[model samples]
Target: MFQSTKQTAQTANLTAGGHALPADWLGRIVLIWSGYAVSMFAGNAASYAGIWYATETTGSPLSLALLYVLAFLPMGLLSPFGGVVADKLNRKVIIVVCDALMALTSLALAAWTFIAGPSFAAVALYCAAFGFVSGFRTPAYNATMPLLVPECHLVRINSMDTLLGSISMIAGPALGILLYTSFGLQYVLILGGFGAAAAGVTMLLAVIPRDHGAHEQAGAWASLKEGASTLASQRGLLVLTIGVSLGMLAYGPIDSLMPLMVYDHFGGDGFAASLVAAVMGAGLLVGSVILMAVNPRRKLARIIVVSAFVVGTGALIAGLIPKGGYWAFVVCIGVLAIACAWFNAPLMTLLQKNIPDEKLGRVMGLFTAMNGLAIPAGTALGGLIAEVTGTPLFFQIDGVFILLLAVSIAISKSVRKLDAASSDHPTVEQTL
Candidate 1:
């Protein structure tokens, strides 16, 4: 059932890592999905445990800010190099190595924390290492997806990715808190380490295709330049990149302000804020599930445009709700989260289909760096705006900007033509 007869022996013979394509392609995908899901859960859990420990131990805003900086700084610094490595080297090896490094780093930190008790320095060190590794890991893993799954199912696979990620985010924090409270920070950290190790081992067993005509022999700077050139030359991709970055910037502050919005605007406590956050997560989970099941493979552009509008509208509605309208806020946030799943899944699929596998790592890495920069900048600006005009005003203004961005994308000839163009020039499927 997995390998249809129409996919003849020649296609089946085109192997990943010199091995024949598995008969049960579906089963292989399931295994890969399970491994990554565990890794995501562990990573999120460890992050929460570290942050909670830092907050409880230091109780210093500066220390928390430092923690945040450590979490992101390495990724910003190493992303370009990561992209180069991903394109130049065996992607599967990079994945295994990065995951293993993260596992080892987490384990060492767990031991240190256990021996000396929790310290901000130890946690910071672990975060920095993990972040550095992630810079390399993310693109390699993403680039591997097309190799494992057929293009026809890419949207469904991407939706499932978001679904599992939302589930991990929702459960990871609670698990971290539970483990930390019941056992200790050390145990939580150890759990994260085990999760990473398991993910690495699992992927190690899964075959990935070698790079075809990759710019491996070229100088790193030249390769980087080529990746940049690819993005610059592709009008549709360039438009999508700019639009997504701006959207991230516009919405960045909302991520950090949800709890504040619940508490200050609705006169609610931490528990109530948690409930709102949970509802948003639940919404994402639901949206992902539907996308995965329905697996819409057409009208990708319209979906993206409509979803972006929904996201902006949801944010605007959240801000417009009157004081004490807690349920209204929850509903708005839920819609926003659902729209996010729709916004992200097809967008990722579109990029994957358009970009060549040889350059995907570099493109994704550059994109990640751009997103990283935009989000923090937007977050800082949002904070300043909120301080001056209040959170609701900031949200309202941000919403308008996002809505405008979506309208522009909807009208853009390039964006409207992306999916159809992508389909006409299909990527060569890598079988394993």
Candidate 2:
């Protein structure tokens, strides 16, 4: 009985990290994820500063919109190559380089905020250049994460990432609001810049173990071709990326217009606008925690199908609700965040699992790229809808498009069969 009990106890101590995961791997995730969390917090705080600083001093709505649009333009254009770099180079080095670059950008923003003040054109130019630099890092990190954790527990680790990011999302905006209100946006901008630099310093200390199985034989162009070809082969991942892109297109407008939503509805104070955004971030935190608790053991394809449906349903419901003003709109968005979290967590897990490590970066790059693929279009759609209708209809129509995309994925048998075998087959996806 004593021996049997000992065996049971040992089994209980073992986590999913034991399978397809290295020994002492969880330690690495904690070490790396902690550094990443701080870095992201400072980075996002700087983002909030950029938006609020531009809006308060310059008061240009277009400048405000430029903040969102310009930030993403880099990712949209360069993400494919970023992924290729992730596969060819050491992922740890890539992450360090990316964080270092962000640190520099943050410092530049701080300088610009103080020295240049708020020039709409200057801020626009600043944002565009910053966006260009960020594109390479996004895919690099996504592909690198699985190197830190095991496969079977991808959901738990992803939920962990979301939880950390949620902390950043909630804190960054709130910090931006508080600093901007009390110390002024200039100080907030400067502080965020320093924080990003500090994060870079922290990231420099992290050591990611090497993957012996990683692809190293090919040159940059040849490696790029191989990664692209693999993604193209995965019909399921391709469909999934496209569906995710639709949801992202719908969601982008929400961030761009939230400040206006707060003013129209919440009382026109910067605090009120920031509070409205914070509620959604808080909901995301809650939702991520919940997902971590109850990871689905079913098919990857099915989880995605259900998640998309839920996202569409939430957007539809939020759109159907009557908007009384800012606070009311925020309340609706908060609920929407829950739905978004549920769908996003599982979809992320699916991508991390099916794609091989060698090509994971570029694949995740393409995956991440899909998030912004329709942004230019979403902006046009949102602007047109806002003019003709209102925010509510904008949400509803985008929700419908998201739902249709999900349905398209569900209907394709080939796409839905990604989990039929446990083989780590090379996969391929394309946007154009």
Candidate that would win on TM-score: 1
Report backbone clashes per prediction.
2, 12
Model 1 agreement with the true structure over 1-432: per-residue lDDT tens digits: 225343534444533222345566677777777888898888777776676676457544345545555655567667777788888888889999988998998899999988998777888897788768878887777777777766667888878878887888677767776787788888888988888998988888876667443546898789888888988888987888888888888876777566567656777754565566567778889889988887776667778788889999988888898897888888889889988888777877777767877888888777776666666567667766777787787789888988999999989998878767645532333322
Indicate the residue-level lDDT of 381 in model 2: 57
lDDT of each: 0.76, 0.65
TM-scores of all candidate predictions against the true structure: 0.85, 0.84
Give the residue spans of candidate 1 off by over 4 A: 1-22, 49-69, 115-126, 211-215, 263-273, 420-432
Score candidate 2 by TM-score against the native.
0.84
List model 2 lDDT by residue over 1-432, tens digit each. Answer: 555556444533443222244577667677777666776676566567667766577553345555667767667777777777777677667667766666666567666767776455544654665566667777776666666665546778777767776778778888877876676556765665566565556556766655523647666667666766777787776776676677678677766666654554334677776776678778788878888887653465676677678767766766665545555566777776765676656767777766666667767777666664556446545756655666567668777877887788889877657655432332211111
